[model samples]
Target: MIKLPKILKYPNFSRLYYAGLTSELGSFVTETALMLLVFKLSEGDKSKLGIIRASFLFFLTMGSLLGGPIGEKFNRRNVLIFANIIRIPIITVLFFSKDFYSILLVNAMVAFFTGIYNPSRQAMINDIVPQKEISIANSLFGSTMAILHMVGPFIGALVFSKMQGIDEILTFDLITYFLGIALISTINYRPPKKESVDNVQTSLFYDLKEGLRYAQKREDLRALLFNCSIAGFCIGVLIPLLLPFVTEVLHLSDREYGLMLSVFGLGGFFGGIISHRLTSKHRPGKLIVSSIAFEPLLMLLWLLIPVFIPNLIIFFFWGVIVFIRIPSQLNYVSETVETEYLSRIHSILDLSFVVPNISGGIIIAFIGNSFTTMEMLFCTAILFVILIFFKMFTSSSKALFKSEAKRVTRDQSIQDGIA
Candidate 1:
């Protein structure tokens, strides 16, 4: 038998890690294929692509409104399984979709279940991993995602380039989804003793309110939520804009664009390894704020440089900074939240990002083909500035960035708890 890593030695988390890894890769590949399908079905309307993406975000947000309650009310593992199982039929329908709206609607439905899956899985991480290993666990997850984002698109593009029909990609997605469920079934999870099963609230609305209230009560969480939203908005805006920016302004080919993504992923994987080492010495909050402060500047620098080689360098460096920041952020949240409130707070955090992500897509979609590529590029540039300035300057942001800076890592916190 293969010897597991220290953190993966936890039986439940180990299964969850593999299950989530495969599921995430499947999602990325399918997402790439689905986008191509929608673009083709819509007869190459670029705006519709943005619309499809935005609709997914909107519906995902809607689903998350209830995911928190359900996760808190039901067994979390069951919720994760249900999230995957429910999507099989929906994805099956995508293979038959002929119209743009049908494609959009089906994918958006997948997003709803995914919205639930995201938070429950996030919340569950703290439960299964040993506190000292939280940083490494999160690094593994983030690194895998970065790798998928790097490669999944290319695989999807290649598969679709050879497409006999949409069914092939959707069929693959369903198989992976089923595999995710099966892996989840083999893993065993035990909720902490304090999380009484009988204590579930009858009212999901009230349960949600309680979560919102919990965030409002804390200075740091409120700040973190704000940061999550802005970061999401940056992502949202970039999604619709980046391709155009590369092709039109930078005069790079699709191949170069793919290369940029791959390099970034490669850098992120290394950065995650570095971060795994850093957690032993530094606080997660400090890692996060440092990443946040440097990112927009790096983005600004990349935009200014504009050469293909330098842009690749910037993308790679940015990815490294990002992967470093993510694990630290995850470690921070894991150490901070109480057991009972963890799932709900995570859901609220998901909404924090997803809602703004929707808005960003809508903004780009609304811009339409009316503006020249330069004008949209100009608009995107403005977003970068705002993203930079806000994170660096805001007062509550200062408190938020510093909030966990003085605190100990999860390992230390766990030690303190035992004492």
Candidate 2:
């Protein structure tokens, strides 16, 4: 029910939002098809699937690290447009390749471009929306992604079922990327005079170092990064394990599993709507903390729930908590950092997720195929507790909220005076 505010009524932001939606929906299709193709080609070996998934994450991390400098050195919109344009060739190659290694290589390339695209796109959004409206804007964006996740796969499935070819799905994804690029190309992005080239360091290594150093020196950012890293590590364990758990332990079919994922996406959509409304009136830090605190507990309860029911209600709650928390964290990062440094900030923050994603898979793999569901749940709980306790000790939420409010108010007052 939450509506986008007047601040987001600008045509540029609207174009960006639509572009994001189209691209995300395309990603959903590509991801679903890729996973299916991998499983089929590998004879249902979960390890291969994990490798495919991990490779994409690895490339994404590399891209994130590289993107920071590029974002600062060039116009962000140009970078985004270039990345999207590059995707056409990459995806075109994917349409022909069915080999495991080739598919993995192509997928990694796609993810690499995505990494470049994401930070620049996000930085652009930060530039477009008002300081106070950042959180709500992010929530709306999250909502769009959630809805796409919910519907995109179903549409993919329908298309794939009819066409019965990876080429068809790849073509669909490629077209969406082109659509996104066209939409983004129409936007007018004027970098603020204050954020011009003189303000940004020219050296890539020095710029990268500055970004890392800035994150380290900023109290709220440092805490946010640490807490989010722990959270990502925990979630990384759950993500690959979910489908297996549902199929192997709960004995759910592919169709049923897909439905469960859709339900989770729906939960995310609802959560995003709620977050969009609340962020305009309340501090994002509080909402983030509450959501993070609740996720582990709900996940733990989900583990305890008897698997008798055909539908998994607990998964819905888990999805809701996770989705709600994301926008709050994103809002904090996007709003607190300077526009010129926004991409670097995002890259650094994303490292929290990337490191864990790559390492978590290997750790889980080594822990053996025999690791029980309950054991995994316990590990997740422990990590969650550690993160929550650290946040409490640092009182990060309170500090960030107060500081952000003061910064925004000051910016607004200055703008008003100038106006």
Candidate 3:
């Protein structure tokens, strides 16, 4: 078991975590308020709101697709700082936009920059953190994000309800973004040395092909990515339907819906804490499978609870299980990949979700949300079950566990060589 070190003891990591928390909280506040503002402007029309939300996802996907090559080409920390600086004006524009199209444009821009920001930030962590502690670090990161989700929306709701308009929320978000920029700028870490100039001079197609080839050649990583893409697709189905289910089927109000999201965040927060502690004690594959198995059961239970209970007790439990899956999965991905390619690999994995999310939205639009959710959940559950069985029969699970061991051994050998 690899005992994890406390992040508080690492000054740089502590600053990074605090900055991420503040920025994430601000983002949640801004997003929630923006959704409300769009609703108000559209006269209770949901389609426009959906379009606004979907545009952000679309641009984010574009940004991530571009982010990999840029991060590899430039200093990732500088890119991150630059991304933060660029957001201020975009967010400010959003604050005063007179029409829905203007607001959508600004939000889309913000999403694009945020997409660029994420891969760089992830790469920075890889540069700063030790290999052994990557899981714990990622867990802490996930926890902070979950905490922001838990508190940020409620704060946004309260501020929105008390204030006259969305401007205040946008202002708050802008302030946090600047604050994050300031904090990130203060960090003094150097970027990892790149491959030689000869390596750098390769055509863009070659660079991308290399990344793709690396992914295809790594057997364990290939399996992990396959499962991750499937799980992401399932999650895409679940996310859009959750609020609707709470409102339409459970007869909940907006406040109740917010509360349900908060519960989910709380669950994620605790899951992050648990994962930080448990990563050293168990195989990540085992943890991932357990988390994946729990998700469908919880979703099914969420659907069934309405039959017996008057209130949303099962919703809270479902939130816990659902949130738990995120950090565990992230840690697994981080641990599976080498540090040099971590950012690009993570971006590729993220794209798996982005494609599914966009496709899921379209499918929902065509088939209706309820049917889409049911179909996705059932299919995902059955798929994971089959994978688990195949893994057991073919000894793939043992191979995955051994892969981690080999990674650690290789790291030790490198360190010993340097010594």
After superposition, which runs of candidate 2 have C-alpha atoms over 4 Å from their true positions? 1-8, 157-165, 194-201, 306-311, 365-378, 395-398, 401-419
What is residue 383's positional error in candidate 2, in angstroms? Answer: 3.3
Error of 3 at 12 (Å): 2.2
TM-score of candidate 3 against the unseen true structure: 0.84
lDDT on C-alpha atoms for all candidate structures: 0.75, 0.73, 0.66
Off by over 4 Å in 3: 1-5, 43-46, 197-200, 203-205, 307-315, 365-405, 408-419
- Superior candidate under TM-score, 1 versus 2: 1
lDDT of 1 by residue, 289-398 (tens): 77777767776787778788898899889888888877877877777777677778888988998899898888768875677655655566577668657666766566
TM-score of each: 0.89, 0.88, 0.84
lDDT of 3 by residue, 133-169 (tens): 6677787787777777777766776676677487778
Native-vs-model 3 lDDT? 0.66
Better of 1 and 2 by lDDT: 1
What would the per-residue lDDT of candidate 2 be over residues 1-419, giving only the tens digit for each residue?
99855645667888888888888888987787676667667765556656777778788888888887788778888898899998889888865667988898899999898887887777777776666667767988887777776777666555655665578778778788889989989987765444445665468777778899988777777667766777777766766666566666777654555566677788888989888887777777767767777876776676666383533677676667778878988887765677556778888878777777766655655552666755765677677776676576565555664545323221332111111
Error of 1 at 219 (Å): 1.6
TM-score of candidate 1 against the unseen true structure: 0.89
